[model samples]
Target: MSPVPPSNGPPPIDAATSPATPTISHPKPNGEGEPADASLPDNYVTYQLSRQTPLPPITWGNWYKELNLLHFAVLGLTPLLGIIGAFTVSLRWETAVWSVIYYFMTAVGITAGYHRLWAHRSYNASKPLQYFLSILGAGAVQGSIRWWARGHRAHHRYTDTDLDPYSAHRGLLWSHIGWMVFKPRRNPGVADISDLSKNEIVRWQHRHYLQLVVLMGYIFPTVVAGLGWGDWKGGYVYAGLLRLFFVHQSTFCVNSLAHYLGDAPFDDKHTPRDHLITALCTVGEGYHNFHHQFPMDYRNAIKWYQYDPTKWTIWVTSKLGLSSHLKVFPDNEVRKGQLTMQLKNLREVQEKLSWPSDNSHLPVISWESYLQQAQSRPLICIAGFIHDVEDFLDQHPGGRHLLTKYIGRDATTAFFGGVYEHSNAAHNLLSMKRVGVLHGGAPHGLEDKAIPPSQRLRIARYNEMSGSGYSSGALSDGDGFMA
Candidate 1:
């Protein structure tokens, strides 16, 4: 069925909304109609759900009225029996191994088939490969390819909104499984599935989806173990019901945990995040932030070291002529997204830090005044700046004597190389001690006489030029000077 438009549909039956799921108005970057501020929380950005109205909260008294009977039965009955089967059945090694192998096979059906091939069209698969994935995807029991892909596409188009089929903003439980178990009175926003309709294999799978579920999801696993090694009970319990349970929950994590946890490295404007645990659970779908940002890119984890078995499978299939036309977002563009987030984080840190006063604000003192002020305090003149080094004298790595000897004198040459060439660290530390600037800059006569070529001062750019000088306000008192 084509999705009913959200606006045209009746009010949502809302069966899971709770106090935790507040009616948060769509967040604004800088409190409505202002330019975005990078320092704001992740949600306060351009990419957000544009909803006319919040979905109404659930009426708990009538919660049972909204329960989807078929969905409630399958979801409730299977998991309970699967749990009981776990305790009753003794799992055979053969069935256990098949379950592990089949788990990966079915997972690829969702990731490579339902997700990449049909939903996002990130790649193309050969007819044989398509058939293989469709059958196995049915075994995963997550609805027909057309059904699953339509909802998934809608999820991308309307993420974190009421129209999203499994919107993460509704709370983890609702996103994970409650959306399926309960019926929404309002339809989710529509996604175009014209491409899905054109695919003969998808139509075939949807037509026979129920029969396929019984055959591929249940009977095949039981028969594989029974006929191969006489472990039908183990196969039905462990490989069939139990494996299905895990597959469903793992897929659900992409909707819940992927949105709830981890850092958004690509774009924090949406709910998706990149987390290792989510990747490990979802067979490489854990790089959700990247996936949401570049939906057409076949690979979720773009880095070589990141774990993405789904991407590897697609790549290997291309070599075997089973799949082709794999799409990749431009490397430079991807890097730009990463760099943007890094800069935003740096801006946040920069906001919290203290910086020295600007050079233009410093007081200009005469050369005569500099010599006069030196007698009262441990004042040293270097690189044109008057520094009160009284507090830093004992902390100086060169010892108190070296600093004491330079007091009331121009030590620019000695600081550069005549005594000891200091590190950039020393320059930075000295900058903080600045009290004032010498009139007409440094005393060139005192600094130039007998100073070796290596000891000559050099001007650098930006902060290095002035050594980030600022005053302590105590420099205004001059009564104790020797002038």
Candidate 2:
């Protein structure tokens, strides 16, 4: 719950303390290129970061000396108390209901406030709502907004790699909560959330995180029980420890269960999937595949009735004038994604069986054509089909970085791995991008615009080979060949 290690963070700015009047932009937060509005109030919050990239995922090697004693103790004791309370403790009906209420509120603080709003900057919230969410988030004991969001942002930036704080690739327990106990021995030395480091309110919240967590998480719930129902013990057991335990597990499930099970309707190459069970547990975060693919979109559930209370909560807040500028993925893109997913599913079926596919005389296109399109047209070769993915470079779920290496080259291994495999959706999507089949070299006339063939035999041989009238060994440069 305390401030942890670093990601590359932003420089400080303030409306009151800063020398220049600062602009605010939280909610549509941490995004790049959102034009600063001159019409807004001073001390406005924005989520854009001055420094966006974090250290590579590989930098934070497993250097922890040993288990963190404090984390070890808490992990051990909290569950022990919960078991004892389950057997020995008596709870009034009032206690159970109120405890559920408290649990819901605190969970929202983490998912809605800390995760979506602050960490992802998927929407906009007013200062009052920000304050409300921050306080409740503190009660959830998930660290201050800056601290929580810093780690979360890194998780997005590096994803399933080692740099991710809750990397599900490490295993279920480790991704869930064991990382807290094992601890990181090293730091990134910079935070990827410079936008937060400079926010005055965020800074204030971080400064008082420990005290606020104790007050908001424990004392407040206990006081409500004592005053309302005259059962402080039940309040502490149900609303305090029991509620906290559930919230913690629910949050961790977004990291653990989400990656381990369910169908990946989005990019299946990466860990994580969309799971109804995980969503019900996390109050809407079970749409892990969608969440990972569209982090900036405010809605995890892209459907009308996908059980995303968090999305509904944000929508309601906007209706109540508490939140605004909620971002949603464009409809066309959604449809395109669905189509791509369906295609990938078909690909999986094809891979599992040999269906006499027409490998017969595909259109022979020049490798030179792919070379020319490598940047502008951006093509990738997979299973002998050349796909024009210039439009797909930026839209790739792993970001543009992952696709760059495969430009004008075969990406078969990149798409499949020993322990992992891309979805049938991916294969189908790749197939749709197909422009032509592999040809070793430039075609006739494509190599040279000038010289006409001297003889009919020469022209016939040229056309018979790669065409362009070049010699058979002319493409010895090797870059002309597909990998």
Candidate 3:
């Protein structure tokens, strides 16, 4: 749906009438300028449903598309050309070093430059840094910064889903290089990257990409090594073809290996993981798990000991005035994510471990606080206890999407009688998974209390008795076990 033209006041209330509280006004059904309800209380706000524009469906007439002939020619032939040149040519160590240098610079151009600086906006680079990085990135044989950034942003936004240009879930080869050769259907490019297009440098590079690649990517490296060092063939062999192959493979591994290998300290809901091998290979992009969790932060490797050269480069450049506004998340938040995930994973082994349920050590939160956790870390309050149900969301008896709706709010009604009328064993499960005690605010007309010790035993017995026979009326808040 298109946007409704906004007015100065919603549910219009004159400042003279109510100084502190603003009233929300909706369109009158009778086509009048006033609000639909004339009996609204003074100083109160009225909220109506907001309209959201539905996205157009993705159209793919065919299920599969043939691999791009040009991509196959370029990628496939590069290795062949490099192997032939390596055998045919006498490549000097100095010439090979030049290729290594070029490889490092170009990799940075993609990792630190295109990935972090442009794709994630993790830091602010000076105009000169951005300009140079943009040029070096073009020399990497990768697409222009504009194109790269758009696809990358989409990869992060949709990530692991079908819309991802290089969704790792598609398979290692597909995420690494197969995506370039073939796709599902018509490409929609990226969803939102107008900011990338605004830069004149990015615009110019995108427009003259063919020229830039031929010069900086191929010819220039060849000529510089040949003329500067008296061996053009060796330059072409080592610094051109071989270097391009290495850079491409290394960068591609960030998409493939980073998703498949290593550990997910941040979240496992998505495929991205933190692999030290990938980080070292991709110049600090190996911390895929952290990157996915905190994409806004410039550092993929949160710790100093971690091998994140790109993050270090950005930091050093920022100190040197080549970059600024280096974004890093708070240490506490990072710790919280780690602890949350750790506890979540521990639940799998919770049956083996004994849980001490004093409820004194756990966090006490308000209803609003519980709601805020639902934004990412979904939690549910039930029977005077708050449980982190993020891991259980998908495997819910009902449905993941259905359970998501009641997240952050109390599910006591649905569990007891409203909807599913969970069995005795199910109610016992809630007691087993308690993370914290629920504090009833003054508004709820209830006092804060920990779950009674005897109630735990009672539920166990209830579950045992229900094994023989069970009835809906027999369940009274799990036999008055509800605190």
Candidate 4:
């Protein structure tokens, strides 16, 4: 149960020695963009690096050289014990219930205690409650609160970088359990844990972690079953070893499966995601994207329907006077994060689909020029825009003759509702054929009738409406043609 520490690494910035005053700038915890009130304590700690300089790149030495054999051996033995016990030991209903109950206790020790309480300072707990969680966490056999919180803090600060102790970018195995089994050649990025170092309970637990692990992790479970129902063997197998195995793997999935499987609704900049299965496995730590974005928020699954027993436990404890000052990131900021990601996804989809030519790029054609071009090409003016419908003649669902009738004429009224009201799909398709804009708006009177060759007064009206007329000589240049 006493997992070994890394054999070699650089000295971390002593959390106890970090500056007492917060120097790192951040949004006010009130989330209102207002000045901080000195009366209220900050919801989150400002992690500071002892050295201001950027961290050096990790030096990955030979894998075998970095292997933490003792740590690996301890982890490797638990599953074996569970496997052996499963076959040889018969299960008792009492032991099975105890194992399930114990599984939740230890899982909460990591989620509600190690993660939300200490690692992120998402809430405050009473002395007795802290001790209870500390004991339960030790029983989980993950690590001491100080050690576990330190690594988790580093994971958040240097996520996806080499400095991250268990960067998901390294692969699921590396993030889940590989980081524990194999020691890194270089130290993980320094995370300020001055607050953790100052906690009396944390210090006490660290000093007696191994003893607590043995007592609560193994002996206590066996003793409980033995005394309660004379099921000592079943307790040792299911409640002790098998429960530990389940807790270990389920917690590990938060770093591995949670990151890889779900959608990133809050922010896709990080690897964290959200999924129901991951929530069920981790006792409600599955909403990772939101957790990463608003790490100070006490709740992981913010929605009431979401299964976050850990959040529920914290809330219940607060009501019972065991915990208080539960931090929640503002609703406005949470919505902004969700909207930002939605817009980003929409932009990605927009890029994949074809769009019409920009209006700014289309040519301005006088009515005279429109008529000149319509004689040779199937040009039609619709809603002030000139469309070349030569290609669309055969594709027009109504019939080729119907479109041909509008050639060299303004069909704005018909396109709107005169013949048939076009759908969004139809409008989009028509926009693709827009070769130019009519210098003046569509002619209301000229839509149905053709001007006679000798109607000089009507031609003058066309010139007046267009602001300028394009004659044969002006057609080549000095006109709004698509040159």
Question: TM-score per candidate, in order?
Answer: 0.77, 0.61, 0.62, 0.79
Q: In model 4, where is the ten-residue run with the lowest total lDDT?
A: 448-457
Better structure of 2 and 3 per lDDT: 3
Say which prediction, candidate 1 or candidate 2, comes out ahead on TM-score: 1
lDDT of 3 by residue, 1-483 (tens): 534545853554445667685587754443222432344344222111112232333337532346567777778898899999899998798897899999998899899888898888888888899888988898888888877888888788668765577888768988899778664433422355666766777788899889988887889889989888787998888898999999999999988999999999988889999988888888888999999989999999988899988887888898899999998888888999998788666655554655434443455565565666657677677655667777787788888976777777777666657788666656555656666555542124222222333243332323456442111111111111211
Model 2: per-residue Cα lDDT at residue 388: 70
lDDT of 2 by residue, 284-366 (tens): 99998888888999999988978899999999999999999999887777778776787678756645742211223234556
Model 1 bad stretches (over 4 Å): 1-55, 438-483
Ranking by TM-score: 4, 1, 3, 2
Clashing pairs in 4: none
Compared with the true structure, the alpha-carbon lDDT of candidate 2 equals: 0.71
Tell me the tens digit of each residue's lDDT in model 4 across 140-251: 9998999999989989978887678888998998889888888763467667666777789999999999999999899888898999999998888899998998999999
* Alpha-carbon shift of residue 412 in model 3 (angstroms): 38
3-51: candidate 1 lDDT, tens digit per residue? 4549945765445654656685653443223322223345522333343
lDDT of each: 0.80, 0.71, 0.73, 0.80
What's the residue-level lDDT of 275 in candidate 1? 95
After superposition, candidate 2 runs with Cα above 4 Å error: 1-65, 185-191, 352-483
**Where in model 3 is the C-alpha error above 4 Å?**
1-65, 186-190, 353-483
